[model samples]
Each structure stands twice: as C-alpha cells, then as structure tokens.
Target: MNGILSMPGRSAESLVDVPHTLEPPARSTLPPSAQRSLKALRLSAGFWFLIALVGQWLFAWYIAMVYARPVLSGTPEAINNTAKITGYIVGDGLGNSLLISHVLAGGLISMLGLLQLWPWLRRRVPGLHRWNGRLFLALGMLGALSGLYLTWIRGSRLSDLGAIGISINGILILIAAVLAWVHARNRNLGQHRQWAIRAFLLVNGVWMFRLGLTAWLLLNQGPNGNTAKLDGPFDLAWSVGCYLVPIALAELYFRAESSRSPTRQWLSAGALGASSLLMALGVFGAWLMLWRPHL
Candidate 1:
C-alpha cells in the first residue's frame, strides 16, 4: 500500500494517505450592550414619531371643529374679526360663507397634511400630494393677505402681533412649500422632503398654539384661571414656541440619526422625553380642569 501511495501519479500528502481535521465555524461575537442599544434606539425613535403624529392630529381636529361653527355665529371679537376679514374680501352677507369656506378648505388640507407623513401615501400620491400642496399654498396666501389687510384695519396691539406672527408663519410656509415643489420637480428628494417637513410644521402652528394654551390652562388650574390670554406677549410667545419647538425637535432627531453617535442620540432622546413629559403634565391639568365643575 505504501509503494502504491508513492507512485508517480499519486502523492503521499493526498487525502488517500492522510486524515485532515476540519476547523469549527467561527461564531458571531457582537457584545450584548451593542445589541441592546440598537433595539433601544429603534424603539425610542418609533415612540417619538408616534407621539408627534397623534398630538398633531388631535390639535388639527379640535381646531377645525371649534372654529367652524363659532366663527360663523360671530359671538367673540376674535371670531368676529376672522369672519369680517373673510367677508370684506368677497363682500358683506358673505362673512359666514367666507368663514365656512376658509375653515372647510383649511380642514381638508390639514387632514391631508397628516397623511403626507406616511411613507406609502408620500410615494403613491406624489402627484396628488403636489396638487393638494399647491392648493394649500394658495389658501395660505389668500388667508394671510386678507389677514394682513384686516390686521391693519382692525387689529389691537396684541391682535396686530398675533396677526403678524401668523402672517410671517404663513409666508414661511408658502416659501417652504414652493421650494419643496421645485426641489421635487428637480428630483432632489432629500431637500424636498426636508422643506416639506418644515412647511407641514408651520401649517401646524395654529394647532400647536391651541395645544400649548390648553396645556398651560391645565397646569394653572383651568382655562379661566390660566392667565395666559390669547393676546399680547403670551400670544406671540405661544406662536414662536409652537413653531420653533417642533422644528428644533426634528433637527435633533435628524442629527441623531445621521451621527450614529451614542452621546448625541441619548441627548436628543432625553430632550424629547422631557418635552413630552411637560406636554403630558399640561394635558393632564387641562383635562382635569375641563372636567371639573365650578363651585
């Protein structure tokens, strides 16, 4: 057998002459902490996004319902001014008509605003989204221009500030929307998406203000007790807070996602957690006051 193995055509090192031991397969070696951290990040991101969406929707619905009917009745000065402004542009006898039209249009657009966040809707309804977006832009321009005219004619110092805040926000939203459309047309999806997010947040200003007021009132005991009236510095502060806070949050979230740095991610997450806690406290206080009876 040894002579055969040593033959010219056969080598002694061949499988026929030796047994080889196979090495065991290498095992995955990820540390437990790394795995846990990834899971935690994913959960945190999902939770934060959900909170933003739900909070936005609730505020939108409340505004649409409250303003739609009361503004038509012409009971409050604020509501009266809104109605008169709408009426003045078109004509008298059209005050309620204009109010209804604005509310209905605003409500429809705001409703779609929520859907724009959905990945599927954003992809499938790009054209429809763009069209509705144009309508929203037009509505904003008309509303803001009319609001400016009326503000000049009838706004109080506080009302003037409020009107200016809303108008500025409106103009910003219009610019952002237009830029988003242009970027989309140029196939610059990243910039387009960013601009769209900004526009959507601006459009949500009124909703945010309402929520902030509701929150403040709750914390202070009730709407009546809440000293922060819908005027003057309070109104301006509310508007600024609503617009700036969300944008700040979105920026932090984007930064965290891009950096992939644990420190940044944790910092952003903590800020969001604190803001959410404060909002929760406000909401709880408001709910308690709203439900409680007056002695």
Candidate 2:
C-alpha cells in the first residue's frame, strides 16, 4: 500500500494496475473444458452474490421492523423483546444511541455496500456509484466502531470468545474500509474492488453469523455443541468463521479467476457451487427461524 501511495508522481496517468486486477483475458491457452469451468465459476460467484443480496435485504427489513420500529413508535423498550443484548437501557443514553446507530447503519450498509459492485451501475451511473460508495464506507465504519464499543465496553456480547470474534471482525472492517478508500483514491480500481468486497463481507459478519446459526439448528433439528448463553464450542468457532469463510471464498474466486489452471478453476467452481447451496439453505433457515418470526 505504501508502494501504491508513494508512487513517484502518483497521478492516475502514472499509476500501474496491480497484478490481481481482473484485466481482459489474453487469448486463452485454456481448453474448452477449462473455459467452461471458468464460466461456471463466474456464474456461481454471481449466483452466490445474488442470494446474499436477497438475504441481506431481508435482514435489513428485519432490522428496521424489529429495532427501528419501536424507537420510532416511542417505545424503545420494545427492542428488548427481540434483541439479544444492548437493547434499550433506560439510563444508558450513550449505549442506546450506539445500539441504534450500529443496527440502523448496519441495515443501510447491507443494502448499499453490494450495489457498488454492480458493473452496469458503475459504468452507467458512476456518480451515483461514487457517492453511494462514500456513504457505504462511512456507515460501515460507524457500524464497526459502534459495534466494537457495544461488544467490549458495554459488555453486550454473550461470551468472552464471541466478543473477541466480533472485535476481530471490527478490526477487519476498519482495515478493509481504509484500504478500499485508499485504493480508490489511488485510482487502483482492481485493488479497490477487492478490498471493497472484503469490507462488505466483514460488515455483514453478523448477518452471516445468524445465517450459519439458523442453518446449523435446522440441520441438527436443534442446537449441537451449543448453549443458551452462546458459550458453546460451535458458537466460539463461528465467531471467526462467520466472516472468515466468506472472505476465504472470495479469495478462492480471485485466485481461480486469475489462474489459467483448469484444475484450479474446476475446484473453485465446485467449491463455489457447494457454498452457494449451503448459503441458500442458510438464508432459508434464517428467514424462517430468525427474521420472519419477528416480522
């Protein structure tokens, strides 16, 4: 990043793209099967994002309905009915404020962050994309900061390890957000896009957590290695896995997209396809068990 920021003249004209940039394909040495696998990988990635967007929008709606609705209705105490922790505490003005900002901003960013990735939107309405990107980054940072404060300072987490998981997520969010902005400022669109995707994943960590939990419960027909207090083994592991899994998958997509290896492409394609299937099931479980009940 210093190399990028410290480039001699640092002008757009003088800047060079990073190796990972999704440049147009050179004439392919790839066989037809590899080409087909690459195509499948792209499609599967797109499908995964599409499913994620649907789930996220539903989650945003859930946040508004469950959290924001009460505040707007002058019954902020109603939040405690559905919220696990950090709900309206009558005397804790700062804590309540942070809770509102964290959840509301979370909803906004969930909807906005992914839009920045739309190629047609970026190409056709660059101005909107830029402005939306700025707002998305701002809200994402706010959400991360507020969430960390709530988790650690306010003691909103269910378990110590869970708090650590969320804390790690917050740090990743900050790093990714900063890098995304810096790369954009440097006119390095490839790196910017990569970092932005990471920021998106990190910001959506809570959503992923809920999805994973619901999926697990549905699969097991009940909790396994779990507890009511969220101190169970599965809960502790998921604290990190929620964000890590998505980002790791994204990295695999990046590697597969860039590589000419048929084997890598096929492997990535299969992995992405399986992940999409799991995510789809998770989304269903989340909507059925977590979100829809409240709505």
Please list the C-alpha lDDT of all candidates, in the order they appear.
Answer: 0.54, 0.81
Segments of candidate 2 deviating more than 4 angstroms: 1-20, 24-30
How would you encode candidate 2's per-residue C-alpha lDDT over 175-267 as one tens digit per residue?
Answer: 999999999999998899889888988988988988888888888999998888777899888889999998998888778777778788779
Off by over 4 Å in 1: 1-45, 55-98, 124-143, 146-150, 153-158, 222-229, 277-295
Residues 1-295, candidate 1, lDDT per residue (tens digit)?
1232234763221211000121111112324543334334444544544455555444445445556555566542344443323333334444444445545555665556655554444455677767766666666555544444444543422444556666676667667777877887887776766677677777766556666777766555554422333555565677677777877886675555444355665677677666666665544443344222211
Error of 2 at 81 (Å): 1.0
